[model samples]
Target: MTKVYLALAHQRQRWMNDLFQRGYKKKLKEEDLFELEERNTSSKLCDEFETNWKLVVKNAKQTGKRPSLLKAIQKTFGVRWCLYGLLALVKTIRLSQKSLTTTTTGEIINLGATDVLRFDFLPQYSQYILIGPIVSIVFVFLLWQVVGVSSLAGFLVIIIGFIGYSLTGPCFGKLRNKTALRTDKRVRMMNEIVSAMRVVKMYAWEKPYASLIEKMRSSEIDKLLQSSYFRALSISSSYVANKVTIFAVFVVYVSLGGRLVSSQVFAALTWINLMRFPTATIFGWGVEYLSESIVSIRRIETFLLLDEKEASILDDIKINTKRNSASIVFENFTAAWDDVNLAYVAENRDATQRKTLENINLQVNDKKLLAVIGPTGSGKSSFLNAILSELPAKTGGVKVRGRIAYVGQIPWVYSGSIKDNILFGEEYKPERFRAVVKACALTKDIQSLQEGEETLVGERGVTLSGGQKARVNLARAAYRENIDIVLLDDPLSAVDSNVANHLFHECVCRYMKNKVNAFYESFIMYG
Candidate 1:
């Protein structure tokens, strides 16, 4: 029985390896193998098969020598420590590259969130280009000694190759810059499409927006094609340079009346072949990487150097012993979304300096409901933003005595189950959960769902109605047990009058009335 099982496992491994090799060669899609019923085995077995197959593919790509030749070489040579060292170095490089790529990606995301524009993304990629050339030069020098090549000839070849490589830099830079522009345009288009998807559908602007996105994508593809052409030319040139150097060395040796013995000739050729992979990799991918890294570094530097919003003085304010009580006091405060530094930079300083809110004295005592009433463009929302320290305070400041919970004018929902959103990271309590759900009038909505509170809410609650989304948003705030203040930005606006009244009475009046609440309003409520 044991032998039979072992035989089966070996056969399965061989079959999977063959399948993977064919997939690598583009003979079949790897996904097709997964779809086969017979291939459905234990995950552990599958993982082992995959690991072995990857090793096989990697070895095949790195060396063109037959298995028999490799075995013979291994037998002739005890252990090639240089080859082992090279493999280890390559592994280290790959691990470092992965970590750097992840960190750089995170930095790019953070920089995008800031106000900085037109950041170059090339610098991260360009470092490899600088490092690769140095390694290649050292390896070539060592190769010259091993092959007993004339010093003068080797030096001439090195100088020629370096000059040829240097000439491609300007072309690569130009291509990279063009590619960067196209990439920026594509990103902008994608952001616009995502943000205005609802408006686009409502206004029947789908065709136009789609066309615009397609146009940008097409333009980006064109830029990529042009860049690829330059990249291909550089790679081909590097390969040709290697060939030329070998020919030149042979000619120089013969001209110098140097007897080229078979052993010497073969050794030189073999060493050259060994150098080909790293040399080609350095000149080809290294050029592209350098161009990209330079752009990335510049963009990151520009973003990092941008004048960020000054840290709020209130950040250092300690919470008082009155944890259950919350109060906010803004004394003759003047605030704006615009940067104060911009006023100094502008030609017409006074004209450019526009305050969103000016001389706004406001106070909301602990456990009191404060209503802020205003007409259109009356800076009602700005008042709330100022309290949150989102808008910069030009004169005076806001003092908040406790933690805050804010429900924005636009209801925000994350992708998760309803229960998860409400619970957030807090310890789940069934009683409090039930109470908040009922208070927010989400009981019926939860019951109607197939999975109840555990039902998955699609991205940004796309699956829920406007009123349902607003209620869930409200429930999340209401469910927080430790909230000392609640800032409601017309939460009732999305629901019907009946539901609004119910929510106001149950959720706001009964529950939140005891907590300090700042409610922004644009209309009168009969209730």
Candidate 2:
């Protein structure tokens, strides 16, 4: 009876080995199949998104409005499939415009470049933060099944390693903050140096500035290196933990007089190896990424919370689309540029301050022309700014009952055709275009140019001369159809006497006849 039972058991063992081999082979085949399937799935996702984005862009162009990424996605894909990364990006862009007035250019750049990218890492490895623990628990159960009570020793070592890795999260967060700040400083310094390179060369400040930038770069690199060291330790610890877990499990199993069969021993090692990745590698990386993301979120939150431009300040001025009686009225008005401190100053009433334009009492009823004459720092620009609602009111109110067309002191132009600059996004009318060109004295200039109205002016009108740029600026304001007030802030300063006279008489007097014109001239006031 004993011989018969032993023979039956041996037969069953052989059958089980054959079954396991077949299953393992099938798993390898399935892995290959799933890999290709995943690749195709990812490709399809990207292609679909590209098609939808193109449609959104086309619609935006036709309607002349900026496309919302969220709307585009919601239209094509269901709301349930919404990606938080895209949502966060859209929100950042919307809030960032408000931050522009308060935040530095470098800080804004870092938010886009570095802080936004931190979100990318979160979706990839962040799942491991939850999955790691659950998976580790399952692995421990499987390890116990194979190696019995000895598996506890290995799990204890793993738990210790996990706790150690988790503690480094705060350290990584601190390091990331320092690196980000240094990077912003470095970028800001670079921008300032590049912008003032000509002046820097004149003053021989190359070496000093270079040294300062190098010092900043060195500090940034040091923080990054420290972060890299932590990353290396994490990766190395994963390998060490795997080896140590196997060693401890075997040591305890042998000491407990458990006879290790080849199948059971290999199974135990395999489970430990699987546990190492989720427990150590992925968990460590996920924690670090989470820490970095937290820091980034706080930075972005602070930026988005900064004060925005006060559109309400401009609500006081009434808009009237009539030429019957154009006017501007300022009653006990005091204006200032530092709007952030305006409320505080108003509350205290004893702050020592130099007002931009103070205690101004003025009115222009049924006026054709009103000219303001002042010295360099005599609030000439401030007066126009107060009317524009750019300089916020500190004490009293300003009433502007007309649509204003302002030609600033420095003639500004963007990178576009001269005609585009003149039209300024208004519908092009051939007769009106010709008249504005003639009135602003730009007809001869355009005719002399190689491309006439199609000539592409470089950035800030670098390709055009100062007088030509000023004429282009004036033409922009002049080309408008229903402008009731024209504010000329030293517009004629760059032009010669002949051109200035032509612009004043032809454009301001005849072309803008019946309109209220405010001229800020240094020498004379024309009314």
Candidate 3:
């Protein structure tokens, strides 16, 4: 397998070199490159391991073996643990999305890129840590058969090496913990810099920010260098230990006034050499990986334990097709973005004074257009957030009986065509698409573009104007079928008076006339 892989790698490298010499080109076909069909694709390998792991987990249950360090070691002795760890990491990531308000992007990145990978590399040598001593004992017995009491000297040397690993393993883990934190800090700062690059450049703050990032990077590198030094020590010690153990056995045997036969000496030496891998090499790697894996698992555990979004908060919300029913009803409802305060308020209703949206009673019947007017930072968006179940409820309850769509205050767009953004993963319907485009006042903007709705918007819709992005966001929600209530979080704030008027008249009052709509604004508007 190694030889085949090496040959394939060389072939691909040569092909890549040729392609680079020809210059990079767009729309390159897969057939244009030299390729080999892989029998073991990642998906196939994962599926195979998953099938095996299910059986292993079932057997473990039958044996009544609960999760523990021993059980984990037994179960993780194979490559399947990599898949197990990855699946768990993915599930944790999904559950952690709501809690991301407190978690930094860099921390999440390290969890996926650095921490999850420790599981993959661990099983390769983990068993050696357990079997290292047992194998050493067996080798000691074998050597004693050929060299009698002299074998005790070799055993002593092995014991010392074991103790050395035990002492240093935790120190390596501590260094790794420090390194991982520095990595997260550096990555988080980089993400902030990338996101705010425009502002940084505008103020000519490039050098200062660059210096800050470099300082962080230097700290991270220093930790990594310390870890490298420790790893070098492990390798060098293992090599020296192997030589010293053999020498000690020979000197002790000769000191016993025993005449050494060539056959017995060579036989004893062979057994000691055989013990080298288990005692020195594999044991060293196992200890290193074990320490690193422990740190990784703890990091992942911390992330998994972060607060998840309270998706079940709106248990009173029910879908109803009846038009006579109220689309949304707020009965003495109070909500707050800070769940800590909400939890306190949960115990004592008097603490509801700190809530973002105080107890309020309101109802919007089906197809009604209700406008919520509030000043900046006066909880206009928080009101929408409460309905969306994003804010934790403090008092009373909110009941909804219809499917709702929301357009946030800040429009979101990914790297995709205008039409794709408008479709938003919904099936494309030509007539509905045309109507939504015209209703959201996006028809003119689309027509002015070279590719019309098919034009690529680039990342975050950078190529489009703010008004255009807002309309695109609105059109996305409007395109969805059977939406009973629509929440607009000051959508008109970015557009001109004319465009806002057009959106209000054509989109809200006319196109979405049958759906209950709520508009958030700083001041009341008759339109």
Candidate 4:
């Protein structure tokens, strides 16, 4: 019976190995397979084989690839089916772990970048970690009882191991706290460098900035080293605890006058050896993973719990039900960009609070123009933002009856061909495209390029000149069809006077005169 079981196990293993190899060959291209095989040859064959097997299984499960199997038993009970289910479970676990890690890291990054923090999802993670170990303990106790290995010596060994595991908890906590602080410092340093890179270069402060960054990096590394030392100590102590348990068990057995009979002694030794792996896994690696996961969970929870901007109250209030003639209306509307004031109002639900833009009324009918003229700090942009619902309305409402297009003061361009940037995912109409290019005075610019309209613009239009970028930005907004209202925030300021005049005449007057135009401060009109 024993020999038969062993033979069956070996056959199952062989069959699984063959399936894995076949799956891998099918999934990866010939060149990739060759590369992997070459790399595999340099490593220990057994280790490489196991890794390849897992990769194949993971790929098959992920891609939903049909596995090659014995035709006779494929429909019914078969080794292939069993292995497929097992592989799927493993893939699911791996995917979940990957997603959790990604989400935790993203949340941490977001929290570090943002000003506010909250703790909404911490309880869920706390409950999971707290319950998991308790359930595991229960299962271990049940398994021991069922296996008939419930001896005083075994119990004592477990107790000692538990104590050792408990000792590492404080060390892990301290390490995790230190790690969070270091991570925050590193992120802040990187953010500062990125945001102030141009200024640093212009002012010849690169060396000073570099020194500051290096100092923070060194501090982070120091923290990491300290954490690693504690981690090593914890792992070593766990290993020692396992060895001590084994030694103590034998000593107790011998001191109790138990005969060193082969069956009794060997059974005890075999059970101890079997328990060793699980003991180390649970008390050693498990504790370390749990501690890290807890810290990440807390960070993520804090990020998720932050007070978000209230969903536009206008979303719930249906507008223009009566087909109102007004293209845009702002009635007793107030707006604010003050973060503290907004947050306070959000918490207090106080609608009477004064904001940047006080209670004001405005209306623009279809095919009309509204030129808002104000000084730099007079909330001119805020007025436009309020109309677009970019800023919160403390009281009253804004009503809009048409699709709006907005071009900001700082021209934004993405990395793509000039044509792609202009088209902006809209269907190409050559006549409309040509008209827009001419209207925005981009014809000469496009004609000058070797690739013409197909020329690739570097990230954020870095390849284009300031005027070229502004023209392209204008072209994008101009090319959009069915725009009822266009909001221009000093779009002409970046370009030359002649180009700006041409843009206002051809694009704003000729092409978009039929649409309602809202210009914040900088306004130009042509009949």
Q: Given candidate 2, what's the lDDT at residue 492?
A: 95
For this target, which candidate reaches the highest TM-score against the unseen true structure?
Answer: 3
- Candidate numbers sorted by TM-score from highest down: 3, 2, 4, 1
RMSD of each: 14.4, 12.8, 7.3, 13.0
lDDT against the true structure, each candidate: 0.65, 0.79, 0.79, 0.62
Candidate 4 segments exceeding 4 Å error: 1-157, 163-167, 170-206, 251-265, 306-326, 339-354, 522-527
Tell me the tens digit of each residue's lDDT in model 2 across 202-225.
Answer: 999999999999999999999999
What TM-score does candidate 3 get on C-alpha atoms? 0.79
Q: What 10-residue stretch in candidate 1 is worst by lDDT?
A: 85-94
Candidate 4 weakest lDDT stretch, 10 residues: 85-94
Estimate TM-scores for all models: 0.64, 0.71, 0.79, 0.67
Q: Which 10 consecutive residues of model 2 have the lowest summed lDDT?
A: 89-98
lDDT for position 36 in model 3:
38
Question: Candidate 2: where are CA atoms >4 Å away?
Answer: 1-83, 88-101, 192-215, 255-259, 311-335, 339-373, 376-383, 394-402, 496-506, 521-527
Residue 355 deviation, candidate 4, in Å? Answer: 2.3
Residues 380-400 of candidate 3 have per-residue lDDT tens digits of 887787677666566887777
Residue 494, candidate 1: Cα error in Å is: 1.2
How high is the lDDT of residue 264 in model 1? 74
Total clashes in model 4, counting residue pairs 3 or more apart in sequence or in different chains: 1
